[model samples]
Target: MLLTEEAMKTAIILKMLSALEYDVFDPSEVIPEFTADVGIKKGEKVDYAIRVGGRISILIECKAPNAPLDLKHASQLYRYFSVTDAKFAVLTNGYDWEFYTDLDEPNRMDRRPFLTFNLTDIDTTSASELSRFRKSVYDVGAILSTARRLKYISALKTRLKEEFDNPSDEFVAFFGRQIYDGMFTANVRQEFAPLVKRSVSEVIRDRVNARLKSALLQNTTEAPEEDIDLEEKSEIETTEDEWDGFRIAVAIAARVIDPSRVVIRDQRSYCGVLVDNNNRRPLLRMYFNSPTTRYLGLFDGEVEEKVAVKAPVDLYRYADRICATAEKYKSAT
Candidate 1:
């Protein structure tokens, strides 16, 4: 099932813990509604609390999808951190996780995390490093060290980007020396200015592409299937409201059919079961990733189903039936 932002965050965090070899205890055992008077008490709650030996060891707060970790929100977590014995704190919204530790002062967390990890997108090495946070292998000191490294790395990258955006005289001179070594002349500074600009633009483009690729990879991993055996599987090319109709349709089929029978090709677009060859039924006539779900069932010709979903994540909510629906779609075709 497509997971809601909150659910997704919880799932990813749990997955991280599992990867670290931590004994993934029940969420209910650790995460409980805030009942104590700990300052702000207007229905606010921490997303999770990690426990060790039946005692709270860490406090975690979660933000909604795409929400920024502004000062106000971080302060709330800070307050909670001070009150709890859990020296470590975490703030996450599925994609980015920021860890906090009170190394500088009592109840005051460092400006930087003890460690930071991004779930949906990360390099293999970064992923392996992040895996150390798993329940079993968790070492407070080790995490702190890693966090320090990440902080410096982050600062270095930020400064590099800043320089790339607004080149400095020193930066220009250094590159000039490397690229035009031995031929360096007074004119070399002016000559390499365009090169610097070009390099900056290329770096920006590469970063954008990396983000796009990560998103694509995440989508593919979420959508697990090769092809569905349904004839006349129609595919729609359009946008919708909250959820992607075609994806929901494909998921429905995926839930029901044998894993081999259902196949989701091309990630978001062009999905359906291949019942036979000469005929392919397209589930979606006009597809979209938003709320208004659309699907076409080709029994003989075409049948349309417009499903309204509350959230984009709900597309995968019906994972079981979604798979079943794929088989049904295949059989119908």
Candidate 2:
């Protein structure tokens, strides 16, 4: 069954809050749509108002899938935040929820989130951070610190990306000093500069690949085991095993890199996994009943397509084979 983007976002949010629900508070009390009027002389509905001790503690505004989350979209929420007793305001389109509080200054919300994670993107850390948002375990100080760190971390990443894309000579020299302690001559700097740039790219690519892998694994594990064929439970199980094989491909990628960089596509008749965040660019494709695994090229921007692999399970065995590959790469270098 195809999951709509809205459904996907809802599922992701629920998953993030899973641990919090059991350990933090009474999940039933965390109502989805609790209304409030700040006596603004007109009626406007907010998506949610988290109530505790018979008082509204938080307000939320949800948007539809893929909607741009900007300040304009947050106008109503901002207004509600000021007029009501709700100390926190949230804006989300399901996939990305940005949490705000009066951290920098009272009556003014901070631009960054206290916690942010996509439903399609979560790690153990993301899950743990999300747990703090549960009404039962609301700790203002803890959330504030987490938000501050995330805000700065995001800013630092943005700066780094910008610098990488437009590296000034001074920036290069500053990094050069840190790496070699002013030992390198101009010739050496020139030679080593490309290496530094390449390493930076590899780091980003590996991270992206790792994230995709993690998402694929989560998707595979959560997928229900439904019996599609009437006569053969065994056949259905076999099909499931093929999915397990697809998962194994992701598991292999996870061990190799950031785990988020691997993604899978399973469209009934065809199932495949991509090694990087290449947008349906399959690193390998598996024909359910076919006996081969395809070797799609690692791209060079353009000239994109896929090649075939003859052994699906064998490539799946790459999970088991990764350590040796890593060792070989290390030894070669």
Candidate 3:
């Protein structure tokens, strides 16, 4: 763990720079404790500075692992940005790294980070963006050109996530006005808000299910002979709700095991999720045969416990138990 700022600088920051083909030992390429003249302050120091062709191109500020990389924490980097010949500034706490550039104005650091990501939980998009900073292919012109677009895209994604969790009045009204012919009154707005939220959730869930189905189909070319025979004998039809439940179960179990390993097997009685398509290593079961009520069969104990679920989303409530079951199966292997 990078407890101190110095520890974070040497352990995490330096290693990242090294991976980017920046020579950590070379003072011209990676300068530590780079001094910047901040107006009256003669020797104000930035944590690190990366130079390209003997000119400082990137300035980095390091903090302890637990420290927040907010604007207030980036005061030194903000100050040094104007004085030094650097286009980009990075503020990081070993785990979370925030990349800032002068998008709003020239030579002035923007209030918001153009790019931000956590080292531990980096997505594909974030990884792509981070690759641009590599010393071998570092281009100031190309990076700045895409930085503005990436900034807005990141902001829009954040806004969408917020709206997904809790739809704002304007966001709800925007859709309500389009759908309803009548005047979008206060009562109408209140009525449509929950509906909009539900609709958005359902759309996202459907997309997730589609992707999961595609992955499952790719993994399994043909149905197992046993399953084929069973389906032939009994008219076993899997419902949309069962698929939703299975997707939710796979998502929950994914914390402990791979999603592809959690395969779904449809039987007349219930839809079973098994580890590596093994019946003996059952993860969970979805008993959605009844229209009035549904149940999630958990196998944390000796006997399978059927827990009542109102909807597929309710499966998230038992994530701990589901993950525990997956962990047990994973450890057994």
Candidate 4:
């Protein structure tokens, strides 16, 4: 098939929808384009739509690969959204997709997308978010709640990254007032800006070192005592979520290998799901370092697949990959 926008939708987007277990439809066989009761003068046909429980749940608007899927591009989608009872609208360019919901006002689509997914790079976290759009587990209320949470979190993280890279005057002043007791002089503000940046860098470095030390210590016994004593020895604090992630990994691996061969090794930087008590033979690495984000690292030879996640169940997103990985290391399994 030619590499046109419509072809890309069939080649990539349609296949993805099928995999997600959505009952997808082309407008021709289904009822034609959805027209808004307001907005546009003439009714228009949507590129495609998906049904859950025999009702239109999502409207998908497809664009060419090079086209940007933004508010301007989604103007028609917003019009269609305003007229329908469908809770979600999707804009895609075969490579990237943006998901929108009417969170700010009823029947009015929010300008900010709740979640975005890339067809070329599907992370476990994004997969989990997409799962909510499935026919078997479509819950309007639950998805809306999660969308609201992620939308704000994404916005906050964007602002934080900007401040972290180049601290704004307001950003410096807000933090300076909390730390300094005396008058907030310009010199003090200037001094503390660098201090704040240095402190953040140090904290990140220390955390990385702590995890590396923990992993190395657990993997070997010949390391010098002085090296181990460089940092204070503290008990590993494993969260319920991490343990749940371990169990999910084990269960997925058990499909191809023996469950008994899988073991959970908790460390400072990441939790290792090892096979046959061998650190060299790692199945998955759980890096739930930040409260806001999680990462599952899986390797295939020289390539490492890092999947972002939000919960334990999200680990299942890579179940097939996990099983295939375990099978490759079948000697240890």
Instruction: Report the number of the highest-TM-score candidate.
Output: 3
Ranking by TM-score: 3, 4, 1, 2
lDDT tens per residue, model 4, 1-333? 236987676555665565455434654323334554565657566777666666767888878885777678667877778777678988888667788898899988889888875543444455567766655567999898899998887678778878887787788889889989999889889988987777767877899999889867765753222232324336567777787677667645655566667777777778778786676777888998789988989875567678898766566567667767888888752
Pairs that clash in candidate 4: 33-45, 211-269
How well is each residue in 36-104 modelled by candidate 3, as lDDT tens digits?
Answer: 645526666888999997789999988778687777856878888898789999988877888999999
What is the TM-score (0 to 1) of candidate 2? Answer: 0.50
**Global lDDT scores for all candidate models:** 0.54, 0.55, 0.80, 0.71
Residue 134, model 2, lDDT: 57
Per-candidate TM vs. native? Answer: 0.50, 0.50, 0.64, 0.59
Clashes of 1: 58
Q: Candidate 3: lDDT of 271? A: 88
Backbone clashes in each candidate structure, one number apiece? 58, 24, 0, 2
